[model samples]
Target chain A: MDLTFTDAEDGFRAEARSWLEANVPAKPLPSGDTAEGFARHLDWERSLFEARWSVVSWPERYGGRDASLWEWLVFEEEYSRVGAPQRVTQNGIFLLAPTVFEFGTPEQQDRILPRMAAAEDLWCQGWSEPDAGSDLAGIKSRAVRDEAAGGWRVTGQKTWTTRGAFCTHLFGLFRTDPDAERHRGMSYLLIPLKAEGVTVRGVGRLDGDEGFAEVFFEDVFVPDADVLGGVNEGWGVAMATTSSERGLTLRSPGRFTAACDRLVDLCHRQGAVASDPRLRDDVAQAWMDAEAYRLFTLRDITDMVEGRSLGARSSLNKVWWSELDVRLHEAALELLGPLAELDGDAPAAIDGGAWMKGYQFSLSGPIYAGTNEIQRNVIAERLLGLPRK
Target chain B: MRFAFTDDQLLFRDTVRDLLDKECQPEHVRFAWVDGDGRLPQLWQSLGEMGVLGVQAPDAHGGLGLSELDLVLLLEETGRAGLPDPIVETAAVAVPLLAEVAPPELQAAWLPGLVGGGSLVTTQLGGPLVACADTADLVLAVRAEQVVAVPRAALRLERQPSVDGSRRLFRVDWQDDDAVVLAAGSVAADSRDRAHDRGAVATAAQLLGLGARMLDMTVDYVQERRQFGVPIGSFQAVKHHLADAMLQLEFARPVVYAAAWALATGDPDASRAASHAKAAASDAARFVGRQALQCHGAIGYTVEYDLHLYLKRAWALSATWGDAAFHRRRVAEFVLGPPDLPDRPSRSEEIHHG
Candidate 1:
């Protein structure tokens, strides 16, 4: 096994490191889940797009460098190492872009991708509803074909939509054939939030940010051209998106490794190695878990490079990283002690309350992207070949 | 970068696995439990003939001159078989240590015999108990930070029985006066530290195999063993437990493989990587052993059953080199700098007060 990167890849990493070192803001940006923060993040994203750093894995025609997946991973490592702002455009580029690359027509790609890379068309997922959180196939949102209007008449209410109020569009599955089975007859639609009869209300998350929203659609008109994959093939298409969300695309190993380095720094600051053996061990264990995740991803992407399918193995990645994130944050909070409760703006708050805010966000990890319970079932049934019953 | 074994490496692994499947089945393991010193001579000879014993030895010593990456999977196969031998102690740790640092006269005396199954060599790297020291032709013991190689006839061995009966642990009585000094001062310390890392990583690979084997056995048992008029595997609790076990193994395996790579390449972070692998693999195998027994119910609790063989082996090996906590603490020292000692405050203190 050759673990060394090529000279070209190392050069790519050097370029990314230098760019990020110079470009990333000295002070951390506000959380992009908020209105003001969202606007600020758009500026950052536009700078990235202008420099062809926003979507490095995408084609050059779409403002990308046409980098390999390994290079993209390198970019992520360098990006996080410099403490860059979180990608406010992740839902568009990480989750949906893969599905679009696989399913979108050339016309769709040409029209949607460049704008997406430029952060002109912000997007949020609309999968989870009030009643269909885990059982996503039980969605009751309906879309009726309107031949006269040359599109679909969509009526639905989607809840727990992350950054919905900040986004310009929604991508989700809606039932087109009501008489069909649960996973059948659903069409994946991309609906404009500014369309007539559409409404969005921002909801405060546990972290006290309007990071989530409820989007209501009342007979909104969507064009037939916005239908991704096929009219009755939304479930299959959406599964591909979920796997990307669950796998390396959304949560790169660089995020955790950087977090691990930060944790080590915090431990050093707190004199944790001298003060508490248990806490020191916990910090080290968390750091090792992050490294393990990195190693696991290298092996995973290597297999992909070798023409092997990720398949249900993405479930393993989902469960692992989500859980590791929570543990990492927990270790930080433990080091922070009672001061962890203070908010970012509070006087004497530790690291601007980043640990507490991150802990709150990490809670959503296991809950979103399919609950860990559901992922475990998928692992047992699909990967281990156990009986579903 | 490719992060997988080469085709030849995988083929060698499969060859050893197939050989173990035929010769070192559960009965072979059980037979060793009832025999003296628990040494499977024929299997050992076959592995020697396959060049498994000589994987890290130089070609001039009638060996394969391979690195740990080439030998890592073979260690896993041995773990899967619960093979009643000291292959890890002899082949993985001692042979390589001897090849790399032993004096020319000592190498000529032991290297060829050790490679060809004519002699056994075991080292006491740490702790009081030495694995297979009772039967080893040479016992490489550390005396006051110096490595001394002593023949078995010069030492006294008192067997210390292990929970895994196939493994014969012992407390050896030896002296530096009667032994030849292989290395002294800083060189000996470095050799001893390197040997510890090798043993830890080798055991980590074996733990992965043991975990996988137990998980497979439990999965097979649960499918046929029924409760409530259906297969036990149909229960969600059973499925989730097994799933969690599989998850642990899945994540741990890659770490062990990477540790092997780190050692083979002599990476500066090899010690930390080895500790990481041992900590992860020990936890995964122990967790899988618990869940595997729980899923199997009463049948798995019996020694007559084969699952206990792998479970006990995992438990024994989990604590062999250094348990999960020890390795984590070692990694903690690496990542956070050494712990704060009042007498000698290191980089940790600088970071703390700086």
Candidate 2:
């Protein structure tokens, strides 16, 4: 059980560290939820694409270095440490890109991935609907065949569409055969947001930002060629995306460890909390949790590389990181005493009140990808073989 | 960078598991309370014959010379089986300490015997309490900055019966100029810290196994035990309880494994890693144990069932080397700052959920 990196991995880390140090934005980018912020973040992603730093783990043909999992981890470590702008195209680069590489036809991969990698086009998820959030199989979104137009007309509404207002494309589930059973007869489709009869209205999030949108598809035509993983098997295809969403592609342990470092630095800044014995251990545990996640991810990567099937355990990873993210941010607030309540722009706000913004952001972790409660149910029924209700 | 066990290590774990499965069943564990000395002597002997007792001893001592990582699964299996013996204290704690610090003649006299099952060895670590001191042939202990091997005959034991019927703890009162000093100054201090770390990591691993056992048992119970005209496992509350337990155990495992590896490799972060393992596993075990029993309802409370074994073992093991709070304090010292301030439970809980 070797934990240290090899020379090659060390060199990769060094190269990443150097490149990030040199080119990363000197100040934090604006929240990508805003139009101006989104554009700037997109430009940051384009620069990363030029340097092949955007998707280091992907194969070179997909505009990546084709790096090993270890190197990929190293890259993530550096990426988070530099406080780089959040990946504005994560919906495309992480969730849909993996699906495209795995299940997309060569034409789809050829047309979609490079542009996605370069952030020329942004993507958003279309799985959740007005009535179907946790119970996704209950989605009533329908797409009927248009044989003459050689496609399907999709009609439905998808809510909680993250960054949907700015995204140009979406990948979502559509009920292809109305007569089919639950979780069946569904097809995954890639549709342009600007398609005829489609409208996206931005939804304000907890931080009063439009990080998400409500996308309505009214007889929007999606080409048959855009169907993923074949027809009536969108459930299986979406499962792949969910796995990536909950696992390495979406959330990296490095992000949490970096938060831990910042939390530690925050505690160091607040000399007042030093006398509180309880907070001291709480502070220590924050770091321990971060390190634990790091080691856990390495173990996961090792198991994956060794041909071990990554299974329902991703639910466990999701719960661990989501809770850690929330608790870590909370710990920062607790250590900050009264200052934690300040707005980020407040004159007396600590760390620019990033912790306050982060706390609200962290709550979204438990709610997104899949709720922690749902993940717990999955762990119980699927992993533990408990009887389902 | 492999994180999984080697095939040989896995085989060792399987062998220990097979042994525990056969010999450490409830019938045998019950014997500790019914007829025996609260020690599974036969399983202890068999572990010795299999060289499991010497897994961490050096090769020169007629042992396996394995590191903590290799022995971690074995210890975990022992915990899973609710093995009532000083297996961890003998192999992971005492033997390693003596092998690393004992004088040559002292080592020759006791190391092989300790490893080969001819004798038992235990330690008084972390606290003044000496577990299994009465049953041990030799005891590794510390006085000031010196580490000494005190013979069992030199010490008087006051028995401390625990809620966990499987374990027998004792306070060792000793007077011993005849004790053999193994190392002094920084070496002794190092050996002392190493022993404590090993004990903490081993205890953490055992707690993990105990938590896992409880979780698996609770899952089985919830599946068969019906309420409201359906299996209770179908209930969201029951499922969530068990699921929460599973989450703690699952996440704590990597920390335990990583700590074992850190101590084994003598990494710079070994101290913090050991504390991390102890803190995480302790919290997980306590959480899982309580939740498991709660899910089992009244049946889990009765001693007629085997649930008490893992639950009691969890309680016993969690406070063995260091409890969650204690280890967390240690972790705080290393990463946060001084941990010597008086603990305020109310404020602690507030900060805990804060």
Candidate 3:
């Protein structure tokens, strides 16, 4: 359909552009791989939240303007266009708040929604145990009833818990009935990171960044009120949560566009590799892919505004876009050449080896939420009416 | 602000779909394509009577005054039907240009016959290159800075077989005494470019139709063909490949339609949109054609099977005006900067013999 925005939407874009031009910090925020750097990024996020610019799609009652999806997309494009700091509270604003608003009780919403909006309580997902990843129904994390304590005791481990070390709250799934069917007996819960017996151990990636962690929940007590949706219905709630994560987070084409822009700028500035036709072709293809992805995302948003739910189609976008991101960063690494092997402490490192770091980070994209293999299966069976293999 | 077709447009699409289903069945297309002299006279006359040929032509030119969006809808349905006709060429390309550049007397003389299908006309026959010197009642020929209108009868026409059996190419010999040169200088150059741009959009529309037909044919074939006691379509690899094909088709559909919409609305960014759409459609057709043939195996390559015909059309249509690389380079230029031009001799002394 039509990809161009309306005049009113254009006005919104103009206003957003002006505001970002006036307010974006002169110094770029440090990339959020190290502890201190991530903390500083969180501070910048808090400042944005204070200015009520953190969640463009949330309701006005929840400290947002209740803007149209087009406006929200415009905000994202404008924000990323100006190289604003990455939203440190994305797990809170994009993931948790939407789920809580839909499934959380009134009191639960009151408790979590405002803090998430204000970035007062940072959040991280507690999915993906060491053994259970694509098959989340096979999770072994358990939360047994404690009659005397008037709550449940969660005792298990969660690996690949992104930003687990720094977050104040963890939203997760736990086995409420060990004897029930794998997907039938789980319960969604929110546990404070500082709860008694909770421990977070950082997992250093190849980039030597502690962005991921393994969290051990040792008899951590979570009140019944912390349960998201009905008990034993965590599978459904997790579906909703994971759908939002994959759809909203992975399909943000503006992110890739911004990355492509930076890569192009870097290529232009270096000038050494611009002579390679293969590299140039790769860059051009990446740019085209990003543009197509952005147009597709715009089409989806338009459908939503017209009251169409994309349902499983969102998985198609998620898989396609994540692979595109990998392609882009891989091209960046090739552009950087042998310098990509050098890391943070090297004297001649390129942009602190951000390209190498991005390459490593991109490796996790097709693995997290749902692997690309699983996404293909979804597209085949659900979208294409293929028989089960 | 609405991004969707209106009720009338929806009805128009439905009518076109219904007509194609009845008149342009695969069997009919295959029969006419194989037996006739590349022209389906009876079917063409019927369509003309049904007002399909004039769907987008101005009423003043003895045709219905419809938008380019309506024309796209008809093209998509024609694509779905695997229709073999030259309605797209005569209506979309020839008539529109004639209305724009022809003298008022010439417009009054030829447009009515062209729209009514009383006078059959086809585009210039060349290998992915445009030369409107043959089959056209009046050739819109551009030489250097001048655009000339030459009578087709005055030019010698030599037919050449092409990969796309549905269309025939011709070599034209134009005598220096039989041309009516129109505008010259920069105006001619700009008009020619604009005409090429419009031709690109129309060709992309045709490819879109071919792509959709190929997709449907492949899907149907896979659904019926059995291997090891199962429909081959049930296989994961086959299903995934077809799904990917569908994705390309659907994505390209919107881009094509968007360009048509821009052209219809006379948007300032029409050329850019048209190029984007053409590039996307060309890639989609090539991709879908390859996969469709692959899915059909040996039979798809056989002459008896109709899949090869559609694939041939797809290949030929994609290369027309410009291929994917050309359009992509145009996009790159737009994004980068204007390209350097080569100097050429001026056409100031060129004469109009007519």
Candidate 4:
């Protein structure tokens, strides 16, 4: 119940803050527009990995300090306070790493976790297909067994694969049995993007960045050892992955706090509408929402540490914080005013119009992981005990 | 760092809960609302006898010297029982403030009676409008730079029956030279802040109790009421609504507890935490009350039913101390700094979204 840190925690906070102050780059990683810019961001992520501060929560065997959740929270708070680069390996480190630890074979954990921790093996999610966005159980992509080849041939199209262009690996779901029930026959697989049959096509966003890609797999052979958990248990694995994704990674308030701080600074530096009451209120509300989300996350983490299951309550957190992130970024745009329209090279370009880009980017937040509508349904049914439709 | 009750505190909570369960049933509350003085005299006496009223006051002042957390637990159970009394007003409000600021003579005179449940006292909170002033034994009236204590008999009471059937509002006037002035000047603001913090936490505890009861009532009703040849509780819609209410209540409870912890532990940000608790609890109470009534269908609205009593209490308690909007604004002031005309955009021009 106490929000203030204890003396020991305060000492750790001081240490973390000093380290972050000394090490955090003076400028943000170059905006992920050009391939070179994206690569530089990856390099910065690798630097954090080299420093052993990349994934603050992972065990030492996996290249982290094996810090307590409280310590991890403090690390995030310090990292955000200093405007450190957002974790570029978030998809691999935050989402898949936890899934692999829980369900992957020991060998799988050993092989993948270090690479993930080191940012050596950048990863992209292949969960959402064109038709199976919110209803992931409806995925039609198939991975048929090639017993003679000691593998399965995965053939499917995954749309909205974030950062798919530069990623080396894809952890995804595919239908293993065509005739089985929609959710039951799926199998989770880890496929190398460099495999001969895989192809990635860039998808241009409104901001004109190819941050998302459509990954196509044609008879892409994935070894049987790469299968996560047991066959036909992909639904459960996907649920685990989705829960972690939706609950923890997608709505990390620490990240939002940093962004809010940056937005406030941008407003101060840009000297346009810095004193706008409406904009200030928007920013203030965003900050408050972020704080609330942080407290809620702490409560969830406390529950987890105490062996209590989050269950559907995580959906409430997901819905709440996702909307907050969207609103916060949208506030940044309003603060920018006409400057939002300028991108890249315009004289009025504000941080390459990152606020505008983020506003557009935030739109997909509620759409992905699970649509906000679906989340509401989850809250209503699972949390609220409503009748099924 | 521990967010749980101590063993003694747990026992105290259980004792109060069991006592109220046995004595202050909703049926009793309903009866008292219609026939008696809307006061549970026996229940109050039972609490006083159990020494619950003295749980948070100093031992030197005829009290137990318990923590704010202990008081919150008691208040929460009282709220859950729907026991209509001045436990909060007399114990939480008047006793604590009097212990802190009252003249030595006043403290000696009032502390023993309040702890013994021999006298009831309430404050005249000058909210957006100052309506309630008459029913109190002593009024904690706020002037520009001072909070003066005036006897209730000296002021006039303008009876205003609220949505909450158990409590009434009053308007009073006071011009007595003998009236006690507790904290004055800068001390007044500090005392007001402390009282506001305590009021916010207490209100949150009360809301938690009311919200929990509404949830329980809704679930029980849904379980019994048949729809389409089955209990409506079996319906996912009803279940989900109840689950959502449960979520709100669960979330708000911890925040309220946290606020109480902050206050007891002397945390620097106790004010902010208290405001957070108030805002969260106020929202939960409103949401849970409406949902409870909705789930119970037509029977919930009837005066004969006990559900309305819980609803009335929720409404009244929410407006007490401060409402959700008021707390939100207070929280906003803390986080965003006070509204500056030249520094922020006008409210109308802001993009509004939920």
Interface RMSD of 2: 1.7
True A-B contacts kept by model 1: 0.80
Candidate order (TM-score): 1, 2, 3, 4
Clash number for each model: 0, 0, 0, 22
lDDT of 2 by residue, A280-347 (tens): 77778888888888888888899889989788888988988889888898888999888889997799
Superposed by TM-score, candidate 4 places the C-alpha of residue A236 at a distance from the truth, in angstroms, of 2.0
The DockQ of each candidate is: 0.72, 0.67, 0.29, 0.29
Model 2 share of native interface contacts: 0.80
Model 1 DockQ (Cα-based): 0.72
Candidate order by DockQ, highest to lowest? 1, 2, 4, 3
The Cα error of candidate 1 at residue B343, in Å, is 6.3
Model 1 chain B worst lDDT window (10 residues): B345-354
What TM-score, computed on C-alpha atoms, does each candidate reach? 0.97, 0.97, 0.90, 0.89
Model 3's chain B TM-score? 0.88
Off by over 4 Å in 3: A1-3, A146-151, A178-181, A248-250, A270-280, A330-353, B46-52, B64-66, B124-136, B338-354
Residue-by-residue lDDT tens digits, candidate 3, A1-389:
35567899899889888877887888766667568878888778777777778887888777787888778888898898888876778887888787898899999988888888887888899989989988889999999999787789999999988888778899999999999999999999999999998999988876577888999999899989899999999999988887787785434877888888887777665675764546665676667667767766766776777898877777777776787888988888888888878886699987777778778878888888788777777776677665664
Q: Give the per-residue lDDT digits (tens) of candidate 1, residues A1-389.
A: 98889999999999999988889988999999999999999999999998889999999988999999999999999998888999989999999999999999999999899999999999999998888999999999899999998899999899999999999998999999999998998989998899998999999999988999999999999899999999989999999999999999999999999999999898878774345878888899899999999999999899988899999999999999999999999999999888889999999997899999999999999999999999999998898888887
> Relative to the true structure, how large is the alpha-carbon lDDT of every model?
0.90, 0.86, 0.75, 0.77
| lDDT value, residue A323 of candidate 1 | 97
Off by over 4 Å in 1: A272-274, B343-354
Of the candidates shown, which would achieve the greatest lDDT relative to the real structure? 1
